[model samples]
Target chain A: MNNSASTSNGSTLHEIVRAEISRRITTGMYKPGDAITSIARLAEEFGVSSITVKRALSDLQSTGLLTSIPGKGIYVKDRFRLVCELDVGMSALGNIRSLGFQPKVQRISVTKERIEDVTLSVFNPPDRLLLCVRKVIYADEVPIVYESSFVPTNMSDKIVDEFGKRFIIDALKRYKVAVKEMSFIIDAAPASQEAQRVFSVPNSYPTLRRLYNLKTSAPTMSIVGIIESPFDRLACSVRPGSGRISKMNKKK
Target chain B: MNNSASTSNGSTLHEIVRAEISRRITTGMYKPGDAITSIARLAEEFGVSSITVKRALSDLQSTGLLTSIPGKGIYVKDRFRLVCELDVGMSALGNIRSLGFQPKVQRISVTKERIEDVTLSVFNPPDRLLLCVRKVIYADEVPIVYESSFVPTNMSDKIVDEFGKRFIIDALKRYKVAVKEMSFIIDAAPASQEAQRVFSVPNSYPTLRRLYNLKTSAPTMSIVGIIESPFDRLACSVRPGSGRISKMNKKK
Candidate 1:
């Protein structure tokens, strides 16, 4: 064995073994989807028992770098990347497609209600009625995002017609309503009862909540949406490089 | 209790109650830190039992919109915004400060080890030795982020000196190392045992993992950092409408 794989003193044998394998995966020696050496082979190579090798592999798998298929052998997981940003300009449909998933939109309900005092602030002349659209977005047959959007009453009919019409972005674009600005707040919170029902998770399940306001050039800039995802199944991410500026600075 | 707060027909009484309170908070009727009406008052106003009002408030609290003290009444939570983007040019210290937290750094350990294979691909001329620095970063006495950074052997000394010197960005800047590019992959993963120990979360707890490769203009672009945060406390967000472009598209 090379000096790099040599065990460091004072640490557990299994940790060194795990670290060695982890290094291999992160260093690109074990490419994604590549089968790793068998437990028997690794144990022999590392001069450890099969149990020790198993433990090491299990540790690696827990962190999501390696996956062991039953009956089959272990392989590096496919490198999965999720980037969350406003500038993508892609509709939810496009986003799912890019991730190799067929997205299915299940409209939960549509209701008209009198506007709350705070919600009215998003509108120019703050109207009385609002249309609330609730949807569950599924990717690859798994519900991934639960979205609740509140739009002004005036825009309800057009939006309802475009409900399943591909992406919400496309729907807005069809009406020549360009989303000029958006304000977003992202935080982690316990899943609500409705979220638990939608996601099949227990109460207090950690979930990411993204509250956003989409504004247009028109005087009434009044569309707000709340997107929620169970933290176990999904993540929201952003990469700042590649000519992208920080949106925090752009806040008016 | 005007028409705006009228209950939709189908939802449960508690749900309608929750929605009413949620709307009031979001619409600025109940500003952050403002106490809402008492449970008895709300119960009487909504013509529901006190248990129903309590349930509604509890639901809103679970979603992080409200807070309840032991003796004090329920009040809205402080407005918080965390914008995760690349161009802020602020160090971790600055970031925490911006969020009104007193940041503390707890250096876990630093070790020198032989390099792994896939990690080597991130560097120009992959070196053999690596210096891994692990730190537990706290905000207002709460552990918020666990950061493990791997630096190349040549830069270890200066980088180590920069450790806990405010933020890693500031330390790199002091060495005149300009991070020109960064590639990051964000995903949800079970908290490893070490992560659980570090963050005080349960085993297999959902956590957000951000694995990043940072490249400087210098020939050696060899620092990679993995940052993890408990799913219930911290979130990474991106705002797209600013001049910033999407980093996902810029990948080579």
Candidate 2:
């Protein structure tokens, strides 16, 4: 979206102007919470009209890189710190809590059913019936995640009642089924009809889908599931300093 | 989309049939590399028509969780494993090499110009001039990433010629300017005109945008940049196992 092509210098004047001021703020020439030079002075110094300089300041403000007080002049906001990456390992309820939102898991249905082929192929399993649980997780009363899981029938009685309240892994761990490893296949798919209904999103909405397996330290780990959310509603990220990044770096 | 709503017993017959067979395969009742029961046998046992059974099998195949041989039989594929998360820290050339594809860096433009606001705010002081490097990174002759970076004018001469051949960090590190840590803000944004043209994608395409900053150990990081790709062309993922997932867990 750069306007570099339109200008003779191959750089937009407004953008360049924005950059100069931003550089000052980042380099501690303009410290955090420091008042910036007036727009007119900056415009005159950069040889651009006040309007052009204002657009640049607005851009910075929108990105949260700068802050504008009601009547006061603009000031440098905090440095661009990392927004924590979304943790896929945390339970839906747990994640909502982490974000400072009250969470609720509304259990929609639970049934003992034969495991489906796609899910079955991913886990160490039993040939018997498995408990299939479907629920909608909400953050601050707004439905956000549609989750469904299939677990061994033997573990059904232990979690059926509070199924919506806790992560299946956390619940399973209570039975000494410690999850040692997990894997995820993440993709964007057209939302399923059930997902559409639960999320109140349009049909064929591009949904971020995560299919994962929970593996225990024991020779077996059979719990597998899917979590789907509208792409716009979720924030997914990763940082180099967290989790098993070192292990992956080592392998590389 | 689920057909559960239209079916009795809280599950579709075909899905149930799929689940039963999948359970068998997952439980070692049908081991990996072992041929599954014939379609006719499965159809009979599940009391579903051949088409239903075929649909179930096809669903499994699409997920890369199962395989079928022509006229031979359906056999279990390996258990679903974690697809490698794209390493955001790796250089464009290094990432392409890891993907087993020859990478080519087609330098689009390099100009010494004033920096833009959001970018300038993230980096250190620049003496009014900055080197803006833009390039399309290709994998197997297909453009997969559009990357652009901004650095202090002082380092422009150091990397201008080989800019396409090396990561800016690596080039800087050669001058003993080491990067100690980096952070990312990953978001989905409407594709810009430049991005749309480069990726041959539509306007407002849900472009995957990664904006990052590299910092030296000294209380500050200077280089700021953006990497963008068409959403469909890439799989951007982060495993919770990597990095300080434990710390994130503690915060929760």
lDDT of each: 0.64, 0.61
Which portions of model 2 show Cα errors greater than 4 Å?
A1-84, A92-95, A98-100, A111-131, A173-176, A185-193, A203-210, A242-252, B1-84, B111-131, B160-163, B166-176, B217-220, B241-249
Docking class of 1: incorrect
Error of 1 at B7 (Å): 17
After TM-score superposition, the amount by which residue A197's alpha carbon in candidate 1 deviates from its true location, in angstroms, is 2.3
- The per-model DockQ list reads 0.21, 0.12
Candidate 2 docking: what grade? incorrect
Superposed Cα deviation of residue A97, candidate 1 (Å): 2.2
Candidate 2 per-residue lDDT, tens place, B1-252, comes to: 232333323266666666666667767888877888888887776667887898677655533335677889988865422223545334646555676767777889888777664533533545477777888877777677787887656654645556655656545544565566666655544455688678654323445566766665432446777777655555455545533323434544
Which runs in model 1 stand beyond 4 Å of their true positions?
A1-86, A113-129, A164-166, A241-252, B1-86, B113-129, B188-190, B204-209, B241-252
Chain A TM-score, structure 2: 0.56
Cα deviation of A9 in candidate 2 (Å)? 20
For model 2, report DockQ.
0.12
Q: Model 2, A27-108: lDDT tens per residue?
A: 7888887889888888777777998898788656533356676588888864422223455444545666777778787888
Q: Write the per-residue lDDT of candidate 1 for residues A28-63, one digit (tens) a residue.
A: 989988999999999888778998889778756645
Model 1 chain A is weakest, by summed lDDT over 10 consecutive residues, at: A243-252
- How well does each candidate superpose onto the true structure, as a TM-score? 0.60, 0.56
